[model samples]
Target: MTDNLNEFNKGELIIENKRDKRLDNALLTTYEGDTLLSCVYIEHNSLPELSIDDVDTTTTFFGKQVPFPLMINAMTGGTEQGVEINEALYNISKELGIPMEVGAQDVLMEDMDTAELFLGEIVEEVNRPTVLLSNLHANSSVADIKVAMDTINADGIALHLNPGQEIFTKDGISNFVGRYESIEKAAKEYGDKLIVKEVGFGMSEEVIKKLVDVGVKNIDVSGSGGTNFVEIENLRNFDYDFSELYEWGVPTAKSIINARNISKDITIIASGGIKTSLDIARALILGADMVGISGEVLKYLIHGGYDYAKDYLQELMYKTKIVMLLLGCKNIEQLKKTPYKLTGKLKEII
Candidate 1:
């Protein structure tokens, strides 16, 4: 046990290798299936008297006024490269007043010293009230969850449920028997501060109900149509194939509606394959209080560096406001009340 811990701390070789490979694949890989954003289109208001100048993009999330209802969801953490990515994203978050969740804390849980050398230093350097969230796996204990949150001084903690990813991974843990029990314990202990979310597979009404039953108040419906973990895992291992499950999971738009139908009050965060302003607007109309983005930002940051990524996000914010103006909705609240129609495959799914 001591030797294993020492090896992890020595160079974080395992996580570093995984992180590098995932980053490379994320750049080249294209996910299968629809995000359902294309299936639903927001109604254009011809008589919209609202001007772009009058549109307000600010919305309250995590009990604070965020410039927009967007969050940079968990991406990478726990290695040298992970630290660099976290630092860049953190600077962007600070500049944009956007919320971000640091990548998974598996390494931190395995070796505190490794995390101190990788994620902890960056967290300490960038520590501030920027709506930072700590990320943990679903099977993590409440104690592990607490340590992750405290490490980053997280405003909240996002426990990602990636059963599909785990099931498909070559040597990943497949035992999710007590995941709900873990979530329930965390929710009871932290209440609204606990965000129970899926990795890329959308949450169904049943999943939402179970989470709400466990006292969870925030849910990120990170649906398919983005970075397909099944695909990623497949890329990781060529000896086995899982292509048959490429299009698995619910679409983002439908998942948001499903979550809304289950509970009117749960703070729904729409994510997965969210790239354009139309996607964000459609998500808001479908009952998403917030939208989480990961792949798009990572792509931008990787290809174009920090400035390019920042500019891309700024453009998204602009497009979202333009969408609000076009919809004749001056604010996010009004946008939610705006009417929209589902078409094609999305309507069929509904």
Candidate 2:
């Protein structure tokens, strides 16, 4: 049996077949339904003990101090334009003092020389770092995972589970066998550096417990209601319609609560349909160690380029500080302890 040149890599294949279509589809689908962020009503403090100037909105990732807990989540990569996108993202991540998880790096498995193609030369050539993170599929081998991480000297690596998105993709894989074992192996090898993540399909407490049981300490519960990948893939496939499943997966707010209840130790990144500073505040209140934003940042990047995206993020972070002040929470720790109630759909879920 000979290897098919055209069918070599799923990451490459997804890029080649779709090119900027994925980016375009993502931008188009940035529109989201109720993320249940509305269900989170952070109690206001009539008497905030500390002044706005004294609020400490600081956190850490990769052992480096960040101004806030916001993170730049995975977007697109593994193409020429992807290289440019990554560079811009690097700039923004550096300016904002936050961590960024790059898009899929499975393409580098077949061609390691093209590391610059997937992660950008900026990452390869930089002296000062931005707490960069590499990403790969869940079932990747330890060898493959190492190459992806070592390619750009990533501080951490995110192993993403996107079975819901895959089922909708025309050329996506169906065999998820050994996924748990593969994750366990990566965790054993990488330990605290390995972050198990979901795409837009969200995560359940059961799923998070499985990861926690495997010794995984970082989890990005990229819940539903952002960049509907099912709709994106189904739109690409003229052969069939998966519209009915477009709304699948847990809401972002509830997923945060789920992870918070499961364990106090694991780092939970609340993402999916995160559109505002209040959303960021609500996530922290519900137990997310940090907040992640992808589509909204991508929208800002596409609409106005790097500078616009940077300004948007800076403002978002500033507003998150303001939210902290309003809640009478001087720091991220206080914000987490701030009382809030879950109502509506999210109330029923938890």
Q: Write the per-residue lDDT of candidate 2 for residues 329-350, one digit (tens) a residue.
A: 8889888888888888888877
TM-score: model 1 vs. ground truth: 0.92
* Clash pairs, model 1 backbone: none
Off by over 4 Å in 2: 1-18
Clashes of 2: 0
Query: Which residue pairs of candidate 2 clash?
Result: none
lDDT of each: 0.82, 0.82
lDDT of 2 at 274: 92
